[model samples]
Target: MKSNDKLAIHELLNKAAYGYDSRNVDMLVDCFAEGAVMSMSITDGDLIGPFEGQNEIMKLMTGAMEGQMDTRLHNISNIFFEKEADEAATVLSSLTLTAVENGSIRLLTTGIYRDEVVKVGGSWKISKRHLDLELPF
Candidate 1:
């Protein structure tokens, strides 16, 4: 991969992590393509499904955050990227989430996010993302 291509992919993935960690849904959605697909499984509460399109993805992600009254943090690590072309790439990132809920702070979840990224209209966006949940709660 070219240096610029690598850097661009890194930036895209970093933005995605930061956006999600901060619960910034708008920015999070900005990382995705219009017809992107996202799937997330939750071990607690009511979050488990495959959401298609940017709108649905936003609703589900933002909705999950709405239930939290305390702060939460999603830490992403082990990011790996491979460029398919100047306009496309694949990214894999592992995440560990911790949140304070009902007066207790505990690990809320852990998972791997496998994402397909594409440059559309000169902007990087996620074409698809599959979240593999690993934590029991």
Candidate 2:
């Protein structure tokens, strides 16, 4: 992979992570394609989604961000990728969510993110993302 391609991918990942940490819905939305999907596994052994479309994705995230005293710091690391072309790729990374409740912060969950990313109109956007979590159970 070219250095520039790697940089672009890293930038895209950081943008999403930071957006989530900041609770900026619009910024988080901008990191994805119009038809992106986000899924994560919960403790009850239920899987969140292939969230299917942009609206569904928004709903899932918005619901998580609303009426919650939890403050989450979504930190991402160890990103790896397989580039299919200049326009398509798959990425994987590790994530840690620092959760705060009642003014105390603790490591809430650890997970891995699998992403399908594409370059559309000269910008990289995540077309799909699924978080397979560990340690929340």
Which candidate ranks first by TM-score, i.e. highest?
2
Residue 72 displacement (Å), model 1: 1.6
> What lDDT would each prediction earn against the true structure?
0.79, 0.83
lDDT of 1 at 79: 79
- Candidate 1 Cα errors over 4 Å, as ranges: 42-48, 100-105
Top lDDT hit: 2
Span of 10 residues, lowest total lDDT, candidate 2: 41-50
lDDT of 2 by residue, 4-73 (tens): 8678988999999888778888988889999888888865468877787778887877787785677788
How many pairs of residues collide in each model? 0, 0
Instruction: Put down candidate 1 lDDT per residue, 14-128, tens digits, no spaces.
Output: 7877886688887898888899988766553455667889899888778877877777777877878744677788888888878876788888779888889888887778898
- Assess candidate 2 and give its TM-score to the true structure: 0.88
Residue 89, model 1: lDDT of: 81
